[model samples]
Target chain A: MSDYKLDYLDQLESESIHIMREVAGQFERPALLFSGGKDSIVLVHLALKAFRPGKFPFPLVHIDTGHNFKEALEYRDNLAEEIGERLIVRNVEDTIKLKHLAEPKGKFASRNALQTYTLLDTIEEFKFDACIGGARRDEEKARAKERIFSVRDEFGQWNPKLQRPELWSIYNGKIDKGENVRVFPISNWTELDIWNYIKRENIKLPSIYFAHKREVIEHEGQFVAMSKFVLIEPTDKISVRKVRYRTVGDMTCTAAVESNATKIDDIINEIIATKTSERGETRIDDQVSEAAMEDRKKNGYF
Target chain B: MDILRFITAGSVDDGKSTLIGRLLYDSKSIMIDHLEAIERQTKNRDDGEIDLALLTDGLRAEREQGITIDVAYKYFSTPKRKFIIADAPGHIQYTRNMVTGASNSELIIILVDARHGVIEQTRRHSIIASLLNIPHVVVAVNKMDLVEYSEEVYNNILKDYDSLAGQLGLKNVTYIPISALNGDNIVDASQLLPWYKGDTLLNYLENVSLADDINLTNARFPVQYVIRPQTEQLHDYRGYAGKVISGIYKVGDAVTILPSGESSRISMIELGGKKVKEAFAPQSVVIHLRHDVDVSRGDVIVKDEDIPLIEQQIEVLLCWMDNKPLIAGNKYLLQINSSRVRCVVKTIDYKLNVNTLEKDLSPDKAGLNDIIRATIKTAQPIAYDSYQKLRVNGGAILIDETSNVTVGACMIQ
Candidate 1:
C-alpha cells in the first residue's frame, strides 16, 4: 500500500493475530494449549498483542507429559504468573496412576501419545470449546493439509475427510456441545520465520533451547539430553555435549542437534543452513510410522 | 523478504504435484534427508524414478489413493522472493478446496496438458480462479516432453486458453510451455524449445509485478481488539488494534467509526509497542484516536471521504462448501472482516454452471461445490466494497447456525 511491502515476519504476525482475535470472538470458552515450546511461546506473545491492556480472554492449558524439562515447567509457571492468566495443568501421571493409561516400557519409551488422553480429558473437564495451538504447516506433512480451524468430534478425533473448507480470512469456529476446535494461528509460518520473530521480539525462552554443556547420551544416532526420565543403559554412551533442542517435547523422545548457538541469532542462522526438516530432524515420537502424525492426530494428539 | 501466495490447479494427471516438486527441487528447497525419504517411497512405487508427487501428497490417504484430496501448502525461496504455494486438489467435487486456496492468492497457475490442450478441468479451474479475484493467471502448458516438445502443441493450448481467458475476463494472463517432469523451462532455460522465447516459470514468478495488487486507494480498517493498558503508570491508554485492510493511516488523519457515525482523529499508531510514523494495508497496528468513540470489535475506521457501502442486503457470487443444499430463506451467520451477523438467502439469482459457464435461470437448489449468484439479506448493515474493487473488505463466509461450519464463501458483486 505504501510502496513498502510487509516483510515475511510482519505478515505472519498480522495473520496470526487476526486468527487469535477470530478465535477469541467466535468461541465462548477457548483456551490456549501452551507447552512452553517456541511455538506456544509465540502464541502466548501474540495473545498479549491480540488483547493488550486487557487480560487474555481464555486460560492457558498445558497437557503435562510428566517428562518435561524442569526448565520448561519453571518457564511455563513464571510466564503464567507474569501474565496473571489462569494456567491449567493436566498431568499424564494422574491418568497413568489411575490405570486408565499405561506408560510404555523398554527402549525409546515416550509419554507424548499419553498426553493426548490427558488433553482430551482436560478439554472435557474444563468444557473448552476451542483450543488454540501454535502448530505450523511447515512442521509436518499432515500438518500441511490441516485447516487453520481444525475440528475435532466428541471423542476429540480429527477426521481428515470432514475438514471444513477455510476460505479467505474467515474461519468457522463453530462447534457442537461436546466437540471442540483446534485453532492453529501460525499454520502458515515456517521454522525460519519463528526464529526470526523470536530474535526480533527478544523473547526469552527456556535455557535448553540454547547451546549449553549438559550431560547427554547418544541414542539412535542422536545426542539426547540426559534427564531423570532418560534411563542410561550399557549400550548408550553418556557424555557431555554442547547442543540445543530444535523442538521441545517429551524428554525421552526429543533429540538435540550439535551446535554452539547459544544466542537467538545463531539459532536463526543455524536453521537456515541446516538441511534436515525441523521436526523431522528431531522428535523420534513421530518416527513410529510414516503416518505417525496422522494416526496420532486422529486420536487427538497435537 | 516478501512472499507470493499462488495456487496450482488443473486435471489430476496434469502433473501439478510434480511441477511443485520440481520447483522445490530446482530451488534447492528440498533437503537431503527428505530426498532420501522420497527415494525410499519411490522404490515400491510403479514410477521407480523418484516420484516427486509423493513429497506433496501429505496425507496418508491421499498418498495411498495417489491423489491430492485437500490443499497442501509448500514453501520455498529464491534470492528474489519467498514463495507459499497452495497445491489444490483437482477432483471435480473438491471445488471448495480449490476456492479456499485461490481466495487469498495473488496468482493462479493453471496447468494445461499439452496433449489435451484446454480441457473442461482447465476451464473449471480458470472460472474458479477468476471468481475468487486472483489477480494473475499463468497457463502452464505442461507435459511438453510427452508431446515431443512440439511448438505447435504448445501454441494450440495457448490459443485455446487465450480465448477462454477472454471469455472469463482474465485480465493478467501469462503463457508458458514446459515439462514439469523433465525440468525443462522451469528454472533454467530449456534448450529443447529454442523457438519459444519467454521467461522460465521460476524467473517469471520471481520477477512478477505485484506492486499494485493490494487496494490502497480506499481506506478500510476493521477494529479487531481494543487495547486499554490500564496499568497504573501508563494509565488511560486506549488503542484500537487491527490490521489495515486497505489504504494508509497516519497520525492526525481524519477518520470516522462506522455503525455509530462517530468521528475522531488518529492520535498515535503503534507497531509492536513502538510508535510508528504510519501504517498501511496488511500491517497490524494499534491506533489511538483523539476522542473516545463508541468503537468496538467489528467497527470499521475509514477516511471520511472514502467510506464503504453500508447496507442490509448485498449481492454476492456465493460458493457453497457444505453438503446441505443452500435454499432460499435459510438463515446463516455471515462473517466478514471480524463482523458477524445473521443473514438469510433472499434469492438465488442463478445457479451458474461453472464448467460450461451457462446460467441456469430455473435454479431449484445449490449443493456442495456449487457457485451461484445470490442475494443475502443481513440482520444489520454491513460495510463492504465490491470484491472486484477491494477484496480484503468485500469477501465473507457463511456459517451454518447449528453445525458452526463454514457453508458458503461470498464475494460481493
Candidate 2:
C-alpha cells in the first residue's frame, strides 16, 4: 500500500512538472529564463519531463550579464544544443551600451541591476507573455511572499502589495497585453531540497559547484573569486583556496565557500552542517541592505 | 520521507510566528546567520528575549508594522517528514490570505492563546478549516506557561471547541497544550503539562495519516497540454500530458474525455518519459489513448465507471478576495482545475458571519474577505465533485477579466 505513496522529492518533481505544464497550457508566447544555475538546470530537467517527446513549447532565454562565469556560459550553450531547443541570448552589455546605462563603479561592480533592462527588453522583443524562472521561495524573505504565478506590470515591475491570491493548484495566468507573468515552478522547494533533488535525479551541473582550487580574494570573511569582472585592490588579501560555489550568480557578486566537498553527498553534508543561509554566504548583492532583494524584485529584477 | 504542508492560523498576538520559529529552531532548520539577524533586530528590546515573531515578517511593510499582511511560506524538516508551513495572518481582514494558504494545505493548526481560549478568531479559523475540507486539524492551546499549565483551563477550552467543531463538521480534530514562548510540547514533550497524555504537536504531525486523504476510488486527470513530437521517428505519437489528480490509471482501462464525451482505452502511460503500466494520484504522467480522440487542454480524462457531476450552474461558498465589491449579475471567469469559462454571479445568497457562524440572509454585496454563498452560472459545463467529497476537483477560483486578478475563491458545492 505504501508503494503508491510518492517520495517527497517525487512529489516536488510532480508539482513542478504540473506548474511547467500549466505555463505551457496558459500562455501563448512563453519562455524559460535559464541562468545555467543548478536551480535552472533542474528547471530544464523538469521542462524535459514536462513537454518532451514533443519539442518545448517555448525557447530557453538567458539574460547574460556578460560578467557570467565562463564555465556556466559554456554549459548553458551545450545544454541547449544537446537538448535540441531554441536558445535566445540577450546581453546586458549591449543593453548598457544601447540604453546609455551608467555602470556601477565599485570593487565588485555587479551588473545584476542592468540585467533587468536586458530581460525587460528581451521580453518586449519577443513579447513573452509568461517567463518561467527558477526562483525558490526558500531563497530569501521577499521571495517567500511571491506567488507561484507572479504578475508583472508593463515595465516588469513587481507590485508585492497587489499580488493575486493564488488558490489551490488553480493559477490565474490571465493578464492584459504588455503585462507578463513570472512563473516559478520551484517556489515551494528549499535550498536543501534543490540539492537533494539534484542528487536524486542525477542532474549534471557546472564544474564550479564541485570543490576546486581557485584564486580568490578575501572580502570580510567571504572569498570572492578573482575574475576580470571584479576590481582587485592592493589591500585585498589574495590566496589560493579549495572553494566551490553554493550558488551560481555573476562572478563579480557571488562568493565561494571554502570546502573539500567534491561529491554530491559531501556537499549535502556540508550544507546540513553549515550555519549561514545560502544568500548570506554567497550573494554579495543581498548584503547591501536587508530589503535588497525586495527592492530588486520591485524594480523588475528576477 | 513524505511532505506535510500545513497552515498556522492566528492573529498578530497569537504567537503564531513564534510557534513557527520555535519549530524551525528546535528542528535545527533555522541557520545561525538567520538567527543572528533576528538577534540584531532583538537587540534594543528591554526584555532581552529574542522575539521569534520577527522571523516570519518578510516584507518591509510587515517588518516596520510588525504584522504579517500576506501569507509567507516557511520550511523545516525533522528526520521523519518535511514540513511546509504557510504562515498566514489571522486578522479578519486577512481572511483572503488564510483562504489562499489553506487551499493547498492538508492540515491546519488553529492557535488558541491559553489566556483567551475559544475566541471569535478561533471559531473563524475553524470555519475556514471546515470549509476548505482540510484533512487534519490540530488545536494548539498555546501560552500554557502563562496559564500555569492548568488542566481545568485546557479542558474548558476543549469543551468549548468541541461543540464548535461539531457545528462546523470538522473531523480529525486533535488538541495539544503548549507554550510556544518556552518551547513546551512543540518538538519535545512538555514537562510542565503532565496531565496531557496525547502526543506532542511535532510527534503527531510527523506521524499523521495522510494516505487516506488522497481519493483513490475516483480517478481524475485534467489534461494541461497535448504532446506531439511530429518528427520522422515518432510522427504518429500523440499524448495527453497531465497530473493524475486522484485515483489510478492502468493500461487498457476505459476512459472518457469530458465536455466532449469521447471514449477511448488507455493504450500506454509514460512516467518521467519512461513507459509505465500504471500511474497513481498526484503523479505527472503522459497518457496515450488507443484511439485518436479530439482531446485538447482544459479537458478532464476520467474512468467510465466513476463519472463526476457535469453542470453549468454551481452553488459556491465564496471568499471574496479583491477590494472591489462582488455584485450580483457581475461577470467573471470561473476556473476549475485546468478548465476555465465565463461565469456570472447569478445571486449573492447570504454572507457567513465567520465570527458567530451566522448567515446574513439578505446581504447586498460581498466585499473583501467576506465569505458568502452564491449561485454562479458558467458559460460551459464544468465536471467536478463536491468540495466535501474531493478537494482536488471541487475547488476553483473566480478571475476578474478587467483587472486580471483572482478576485474570489469558490468551494463548489
Candidate 3:
C-alpha cells in the first residue's frame, strides 16, 4: 500500500517483515538469533517493525562463542538494552568444559564449530520450537538449498534429501515434539543487497565493521585480528594497518581486509569491487573443504 | 535494480549446472576465493578443468553422488538488474523439485545438449514451463563446442523444439546456441558463432519485460493472519494481513470476504504499519474493513464483482512427491495460499507420461514423480480461480498431516 509499487529493497524489506510476522504467529516459541552482524541487526529492526508497541513474542538468542570482538559484544548488549527485550546468551566456553569437548588446536583454530553444541543445548533447554536466523542463500552454496522454514530433527540434524516443497509464501511450520524449525527471514538476500539496505536504512553496526587501525597477524593467506584466543606463532608477521571486517565472528578465524571504508556508503562501494567472497576469504572454517558448509549444516552447525 | 527470477532445468549431463556456473562466472559474480576453493576441490576430485558443475550442486551427497537432488536458489547482479536463479534437478524422479522451482519463476531456461538436439527432458521441461504459466522460455543449445558449433545442428534444434514449444503453448520461446564450458554467448557474445544474431543469455535476462506478467484483472488477497494489537495508544485495531496476490486494492473499495459472502468497504490500506491510499499485486498489506463481519484467517478477500468459484470439489493436476503412492480415497491436508482444509482424493482421471505427454486413463495409482489428474473433495467450500486464470489464487499443495510432509503439488484445472 503506497503511491507506487515498492522498489527492490522495499519489496525485500516488506517480504522479510511478512516472514518475521509469520514466524511470530506460527511458532509457539521462537527466538531471533543475534550475532551482532549486519544481517542480524537488520533482522532485529524488521522484527521490531513487524510487532512494535507490544513486546516481541520471543526472546533474542545469541550463541556466545566467547572469542567475539569487544566491539561486537558491546553492540549486542546495547541493542538488546535499547530494544528492551530478553537476550539469552549461552556460551561455547561453558559447553566445551561441561561436555568435555576438545578445543580446536593450533593458530587457525576457531571456536565457531564448537558453537553448535551450545546452540543445540540452548534450544533443548528452552524447548524452542523455532530459531530465527539471518542466514542468506547468497552467503554459501549449501545455504542456497535451505528452505525459509527449515526443519531439524530430534537430534538437531538437517536432512537435505527430504526437504519439503515450499510453494509461494505459504510456510508450513508444523513439527512434532522434540523437533524445531530454523527459520531464515532473509534467505533470498545477497551481500550487496544487504549492504545497500544497511546504507539506505542507516542501520548501525559494530565499530569493527568500519575501517580502523587494528593489531593483526597473517593466517592462511588472510589478515586475522591478533587475539588471546589465537596463539601467535613465531613465524607469523604482526602488523598494524587500517582494516575492516566484511563478516564479524570469532577473531581467530574471521579475517580483516585492508580498507578505509569509514562509513556505510564507503563499505557498500568497497563491496562492488571486492574480489574475494566473505565466507571464502574470512571464514577459514568453511574453506576446510568444499562441502564444509554442507557438513556443518547437516550436523546442525548453523 | 529490477528483480528477475528464472529457473534452469535439464537432465544430468545436459550442461544445466554448467550453464548456471557460466552465467555466474562471466558476469564476474564468482569471487576469487570461491574460485580457489572450487579449484582445490576439482584437484581433489580430479575433475580435470575446475568443474563448474560442482559449483551448483550444493549438498555433500549431491557432490559425492554427483547429482542435484533438490532445488537451490542463486543470486547475482549486473549493473542493470538483479537475478534470483532457481537451479532445479533434472532427473525424471525429481519432477516435483522442478515444479517447486517453476512455481515462482517468470522465465525458465531449458538447456538442450547440442548433440542430442530435442530430447525427452527438453519436452518435459517445456511442458512444465507452460503448465506453470511461466511467460518466457529460453532453449539454450548447450555444448555447441562438442557439436563443432554447427549452424545446422542449432537450426535443427530450433526446428524440432519449435513444434514442441507450439504443442506446449510456449509463446515466448527464444533459442540460443552456446558452449557453457568455453563461455560462448552466455554473458559475452560468442565469436565462435558469427552467423547468429541474438542477445547473450545474460543480456536477454536483464532486458526481458515482465511487468505485464502479473494477473491484474482479478484482485485476490487471502488472509494469512490477523494483526490485532490491542494497546493503550491504539486501543482498537483489527486488520486482515496478507499479500495481494493479484490485481489492485484501494481505500474505500467494495471488498467482500469469500465463503461468507459478506460485503464491506475497505476502511484503510496499511503496508508495513503505514496507511496508504492504494495497494497493488504482490505487495504485502494489512487491510482494514469498515465493518467487523466475522472474518478470520483463510478468508480470501476480493472485489465484490470479481468473485471466484466457491465449491467443495476441485479437479487438480498433481505431482506426487512422497514415497507412498497416491490412490483414490486417501485423505490429505489441502493448503492454498493461507487456507488449509482436510480433503480426500476422489478419483484419478489419468496418469501423465511427462516425457511423451501421453495419458493413461485407467491408472489405479500414482507414485513418486507421477503427474496425474484427480478430483479432490474438501471438507468445506473453498474459493479459488482456475490455475490458468490466476496462479497464486489457484495453485495449492497437499500436505500429509500426520507426517507433516508436503506430498503433492496441485494445480486446479
Candidate 4:
C-alpha cells in the first residue's frame, strides 16, 4: 500500500469528522442525538476526534424511551461525563403523560415509535436546527435513499420524494424557521464497519454488547430479553441464555443473539460470519411491515 | 480493503437495478433476511422468479409504481474492495438525481440494452458521465441473451458507444457484454460470450486504479471549524480543523489562507488528536500555524506556491435542481466547500442539450433538470479552481434564499 493511501477505516473516520464539522460550521443550535447504541457511540467518538482540544460545539441529546437497558443508560451517562460534554435527556414517559398519548399495549410493546414524540418535542424545546444522527444507509432501504443532510419540515416529517439534491461534500444545511436538518455523519458506515472501527479505536461500549446470562423469551426463534417492559404471557417459555445484543434499542423491541463473544474481535468475527443483517437479527420493530422504517421516518422518527 | 464508490445509470428498461442486485448477491453482501424480504415481494408479483429490481426500488411508492424515484445507495464488498453503488433513476425528468449521484462517484456504469444499441438514454447518461468528469466509465451492454450473446450485436453497440464517448470526451471507457437477469459477465466471466476477453464487471471494479485519480500536487484544505481550547493548561492552543480535500501538508510548510490572502507556516498537524509529520489528501486533520493569523471557517489553507483563484465573477455549468425555474438576475447563496456568498445569476449563455449534446444559445430560462452554462457574480471573492481541474475546490451549490433549498449545482469553470 502507498504511504499516501488511507486505510478504509481512516477514510470512514475522516469523512465522518468532516461531516460533524460541517454540522458545527453550519447550524446555529445543533445537537448530537446519542441513543447509547453502538452506532451513536461511534458518532461520539468521531466527534471527539473532530472537535477535541476544544469542547464539542453542541450538546448530546437523548430522547429516552424509558424502556432502555439500564447498562446502556449508565454507559450513556458515563461517556458524557468522561468527555465533559453536556448531555440532555428527555423522557418519553413525560411526553406520554403530558400529551395524553396512548401507550402501545401488546406483548413486547415498544416505546420506539413513542420516542419520536419526545424527540420532536425535545427539538422544539431546544430549537435545534440540526440533529446529528448515526443512521447508516446500510441499515435500511429507506435510510439508503436518504441524503447525508436530510431536510425535514416543521412537523419533522421526512419527504423522501422531495429530498434536496445533495451533491458532492457540499451540504446545504440552510433551513427555514421551524424546519431542521438531520445530519447523518456516519451514513456510509455499515454495521460491520462500525464494529471494525470500534475495535480499531478501542472505543468503549456497554457490557450488554457482550455475552451475558439473561432470562429471555424465545419468540419465532428470536430472543426477547426478559424485562418489565415485556408483557408476560401465560404460555410464554422463558429461559436464561448466554446472549449478546446485536443492536441496542428499547429493551422491549431489541432482540439478542445467542453468542459467547466477549471481546471486540469476537464481535467483529461474529458480524462477518452472521448470515442475517443487524436490524433483521435484532430489531423487532422493523419486522412489523415492509415499510416500517420508511413509515416511521415519514412521520418524523429518525 | 479500500473503497470504490460508483454510480449505475440506466432507464427502467435497461435492467440497472438487476445489475446492482446481481453484484450484491454474487458478492454475498445481501443478508439472508433482506433476500427473503425481496423474495416475498417477488412472489406477490406476477413473475414467479425473484425480482432483483425490488431491492433498489426502496420507497413504497417506488415499489408500488415499479420505478426508482430517487437514488438509493447500496453497499457490497469483495475481498478486493468495498463498493458503494449510487443506484440513480435514469429518466430524463430525474436527471437531477443522476447528477447528484454522479457527483460523488469515482466511476459510472452506463447500462445499454443490446437489442436497442446506443439509444437516447444511453447518450444522455454518457453526457452526464462526461459533464461530472467521473474518473471511470463502464459501458455495460446488458441483456446480451436477448441477442443470442452475439458478438456482432455487442461490437456494434460498443462501436456506437465509443464514438459517443469520444464526442463527450469520456476517457477510460470500458465496454462489457452481459445479461443482468441471468448474471452473466457480472461477477464472473460468461461462457456464452467466449469471444470476449475483458474483465468481468466486478473484477474490473475491484482492480480499477483510483489512486492516481486523487490530485496530490495542489493542496486545498478548507477549514470547517476552529478548535480553541481556552482551558488553563492549554491556553494558547488553537487549531484549524478540516479535511485535506486535495494535496499534502507537511509541518513547516509555508501556507496561505485564502479569501483573506494571509500567509503562515504550519507548526503542527494533528490527525485524530495525534501529532503527525504530514497529512495527505482526504485526511481530516487539525493544522496549527507557527504564527497567529486571521483564519477561521470558510478559509482555504493552501501551499503558498500553488494558490487557487480568488475571484468574484466566474463561469459555471449550472444544473437547475429545484422545481422553481432559474432566471437571470436570480440571487442565491453560492457555497463552495466551507465558503458561501450571496450571488446572482448574471446570464445563461447556453443550455447544454442532454440528449444530443447541442448548445441551445437562445434558451430563455432553465427549469428543473436543465443544465446551462451561466455566469455568476458573488458578493465576495471566493477561492476556487476550474471543476475540470480540481473537483474538490470547483464544485458548488446554490441555495434559494427564501425557501432555503439547494436549488442548483454549479461546476466552476
Interface root mean square deviation per prediction = 1.7, 0.7, 1.8, 0.7
CAPRI tier of model 1: medium
Candidate 2 on A35-78: residue-level lDDT in tens? Answer: 99999999999999998889999999999999998989999999
CA lDDT of B341 in candidate 3? 90
Give the DockQ (2 decimals) of all models: 0.65, 0.89, 0.60, 0.88
When summed lDDT is taken over every stretch of 10 residues in candidate 4 chain A, the lowest stretch is: A1-10
Per-residue accuracy of model 3 over B322-347 as CA lDDT, tens digit each: 99999899999998877889999999
- Candidate 1 off by > 4 Å: A1-3, A82-84, B45-47, B64-67, B229-235
Q: How many residue pairs clash in each candidate?
A: 0, 0, 0, 0
Model 4, span B333-397: residue lDDT tens: 99999988999999999999899989999888999999999999999999999999998999999
lDDT of 1 at A4: 63
Segments in model 3 whose C-alpha atoms lie over 4 Å from true places: A1-5, B42-49
Docking class of 4: high
Per-candidate TM-score against the hidden true structure: 0.96, 0.99, 0.95, 0.99
- lDDT agreement with native, every candidate: 0.87, 0.93, 0.87, 0.92
lDDT of 2 by residue, B261-288 (tens): 8899999999989999999999999999
C-alpha positional error of residue B230 in candidate 4 after TM-score superposition, expressed in Å: 1.4
Residue-level lDDT of model 1, residues B159-201, one tens digit each, is 8888999998998899999999999999998999898899999
